[model samples]
Target: MQKIKSIFKTTGTKNGTYSVGLTVIVIAIVVVANLIFGQIPEKYKNIDVSSTKIYDITDTSKELLKNLDQKVTFTVLAEKAGADDRIKTFLSKYSSLSKNIKVEWIDPVLHPSALSEYDTSANTIVVACDDTGKSTTVSFSDIIVMDTSSYYYTGNATESEFDGEGQLTSAVNYVVSDSNKNIYRTTGHGEATLSSSVSELMTKNNYKVNELNLVMDTSIPEECDLLLMYAPSKDLTEDEKTAVEDYLAKGGKVMILLGETSSADLPNIASVMKEYGMETEDGYIADPSRCYQGNYYYIFPELSVSGDMAKGITSQMVLLTNAHGMNLVDPARDTITTSPFMTTSENAYAVTEEAQKQGAYTLGAVAEETISGDSAGKTDADTSENDGESDDAEQEEQKTGRLTVISAGSLIDSQITDTFTQLENTTLFMNAVSSNFDGVQNISIEAKSLGTEYNTVQHAGLFSLLVIFGIPLLILISGFTVWYRRRKA
Candidate 1:
């Protein structure tokens, strides 16, 4: 009896030792695993579970971050307790995307000297770059855009959008990029000014829009990347016309937005367009088959997908109000190439003072002229060179001048563009002006909604069946397999 009791004690002691060893091994594994995973960035580990993806960055932002080489920092000015949760969450996710991006939160009250150089409020965020030593501020109001237009009547303000992503992305782009295209809007011709939305869009895309009166300035500026003539009521003077002609000859770009005026009245503008093989028609275009509602004058023109201005546009529909039509002067000009950016159907008709005429017409078009540099300065003696020398000379560099014509000045109007939100009127105009520009990375990202989002499921019956029966069946099968193995063991 004594020997048997001793053996039982030894067995209990060995079992206790084994259990402690197993527990130690398990704890060590968990600790090591946690340490390893903590080194990994949160972007790779944490998944955004929000339905509206408010915490997630867009694919455009991702692509920009992927190719980013320069170091960019975002300094948020707020105390830890007073910081906005939306801004903190977004910046955390944003910084995890790229190693070059660093985000720092500093309390304004504690460190007032940190923001001494910046002219911004306590809640504003500043995006800066070390390499360029450039910095730009994004205000709290800029991040949370509000629609107070209707507040006067309603006595309440509506949240337009949470524009944190758009504002931060644009701010970062501005600080790092060195290129800024100057867009000169021609003045002194009683032209309509650009709407606030249009002007803001140009600024966001890194295009510096400035006013230039050809009548007063004598010539277009040397830094002018694009010349804009937005619905000039009065015609340009002869000197102004000559200045425009000279600008175009030197590989310049021009965008003309036509308003309701007779070709007879604006003969100078008509002549300038005719030089590019594009003639402006007199009257408003009406398309009964392709119009908004029953209003034939509010036309929905079809896009010319092949045109450079319409290259990446997914939708073919755009609104043009009170627009005239354009006619190609010469379809097969030797030196000039023409592409219609937008056109009307065969059933379209034009309403003039005299009568209405039925015909298919171009609503907008782009004309490009390639001027050969080799033949410009050569005399008769230079033309007498041997065939080999002439061939080599012909291969010299050439310059191209481009003109884009849109027959509707109302395309840029706030009422029309803002009302027809589904249409691509604003997008079409931006594409036209920015076709020849390079390194244009500005894209409009939809603002995240601050409202509640409900889960929407399609084919409810199928989803219910999968959840109810399929899942149970899978679990039963897995349990039975596990039980059979245990029993066998």
Candidate 2:
């Protein structure tokens, strides 16, 4: 008993007791830290430090999710073991963003009937809306984009971009919307057909695209919400132009893509543009400062933030290959409001066979005009009557027709394609179309390139020697120095 008392007294010294307490406190801190971190939301926990932010969702997605009226279930058809880490992290962000979004993982091996009702394969994601009983399936291949352009024909092909966010957000929007918008592409004027990438993007965004020939139909179809004319080699006939004018008079939206023309006369189309105070020039634009590979013809246009055409486009530069120049005839037209959404550099020049004109030119522009006289009549009544009802009526009767003109159609042409470089051009085109046809949201997430890397050490032998022997030797020296100091003290 005496020996035991003595032992307790020795162990209960102030320094010993403090050390014991500190150790216990450290263990408690670790336990609490683990608990706290584990409880945090996955979206906040997983920091996306990737160069392209492949896992992070865009602000467009957040805005769409904030207004979600229905519950969306994301069912991943794969075993957790086989699922990719990046994809899993990306999907978790959706559930954390909105309470209406729910994510569930199902192993195909355990329960085959889990996804039996839906036509889904392994590694597929089904975004379903419970309210509408509609669902959209996103294949795994769609998420991982590859460069299929002819530019890669002679070189090694690589994965160009990650479109997981765009695909999943579009799926959510599609399943939740009550109806899809109809887009009509003009035909029979030697117009270029829509590229496969653009077509896939339209389909993913829940747009019903159909071909419309103004010559055969004699009028724009009633189901056409937006009309698209891309790279027409020939000019439109008088009757076709009249049909388009009539369509625009009824609050229609049109997108025209014109390539650089060398003596190609599109008089009827020019007439339509003149009505809206937009004039297309005859030569291609060349810029030294803002071009690809020192090729002056492949110009990069500046994005105009003030215009609705580039409202949601976050890309810094938009490429326009061999583009013509356009000018607003009247910047301050009353009935027609024009905004040059894309412009060339001040030093850029318009190149033609005869001569070169140097100046900043408009490459893309958007025009909005009130075509109906009902608003004008209401305004007249408001001036005469001077009443609050007339003022309110005039405000409610205002409606504007929209038109977007892009100088270069090759920027979006996938057939003459290089997707690795022209991703922003595609996004800009999509944004313009979506903005004009109501508030349909289409998020454009650029793909990340998987390029080859070479890592080399300048002094490989020195590095190996230090790592193999120097660190351990230094540690031993540090311990000995401490012990020696204590002994001397």
Candidate 3:
């Protein structure tokens, strides 16, 4: 009992019982703090500090989640034991974003009946709309996109990029949307086909794309949300042009990509722009200051911040190769409102006789016109044929239509051969398209390459020494100083 009392007695000038109690209290505080933190959601607990934000949810996803009215259930058909950590964390972010989004994990081996209605495999994700009884399935292969170009040449594929956010968001959009937006691409005039990347972007944004030949159909389909004419090699016929103008006059949207007219004449097609007092220049544009790699023909135009086309475009420079210049004949046309959103540098000039002219040239322009009067009753063909008969009241009650014209057709050409340059061009084109349509947000996410990087140390020996010896020595000194002070105390 005496020995026990001595063990528990205060030492020096300190109370041993108080010191023990304080230590116990400090440990208890740490334990309680960790317990509380552990109870928090993984999405809130883990910090995403990756350079590319590989696991972070995008603002586009957050916006969509915020506007969601119906309950969306994301069912993950995978085993919990071998689930992907990144995917699990990414889905958790959606759950925390809104009360309308619910996430669930089901082991396919145990609950096979839950996936009976869905065509899903072991690692698939099914996003279902409870109100509409609609669902979209995303396979595991869709999340990890591979560069398939290698398979065509060498029969091997390397993992290219992560598309989890795009695919998952698309699935969610698909389930919730009442109907997909329909885009009609004009064909039969040698119009260039959309590239694979652009097609993929449309799919990811929940757009249904179809081909329309005006010659065969004689009218734009009623379901067409937007009509795209990309690099038509031949001029549109009078009837086809009239059909297009009629469609536009009825509040339709059209995107026209004009090619260089030096080689080919598209008079009827060019006449479509005449209604808004905008026409394509005769020669190709060359920018000495902003051209790519000192090539004047590959001009990089400046984006206009004041225009709607460049509203959400983050990139300031757009690469346009073999582009023609545009001239606004009447900037103050009473019937139309024109905004030139893209222009070349002041030093930019034409490659032909117009090169000697002095001024910045327009490369992209948007025109909105109110159709009324005799013009309202007349198609483009009728207006071009008969120009002189209209009353004042007929012009008063008019409906508005929009036309977006870009001088460069190569902006959407996949044959450009430069991946980075192509991406920038595609971004600009998609931004313009998105701005023209209502309620259509740009959800195109570029896939990030997982290439390895090598860092070269300037002083390898110094770095090695610091890492091997300096850190440990500093820690040892700190420990010794603490111990020496404690002994003195």
Choose the strongest candidate by TM-score: 3
Better of 1 and 3 by TM-score: 3
After superposing candidate 3, which stretches have Cα over 4 Å from the reference? 9-26, 39-43, 148-156, 260-264, 305-308, 331-333, 353-356, 372-399, 415-418, 421-423, 454-489
RMSD of 1: 8.0
lDDT values for all models: 0.80, 0.78, 0.77
Which residue segments of model 2 deviate by more than 4 Å? 6-24, 145-161, 288-294, 330-334, 373-399, 414-423, 450-489
> For candidate 2, lDDT tens digit of each residue in 64-116?
88888799999989898778777777888777889999898888889888767
Candidate 1: regions farther than 4 A off? 1-59, 117-119, 148-158, 306-312, 331-333, 372-397, 441-489
Error of 1 at 43 (Å): 6.1
Estimate the TM-score for candidate 3. Answer: 0.80
**Tens-digit lDDT track of model 3 for 77-132:** 99967887766776776577888888888998898886675765788888899888
The count of residue-pair clashes in candidate 3 stands at 1
lDDT of 2 at 96: 86
Ranking by lDDT: 1, 2, 3
Model 2 scores a C-alpha lDDT of 0.78
Rank list by TM-score: 3, 2, 1
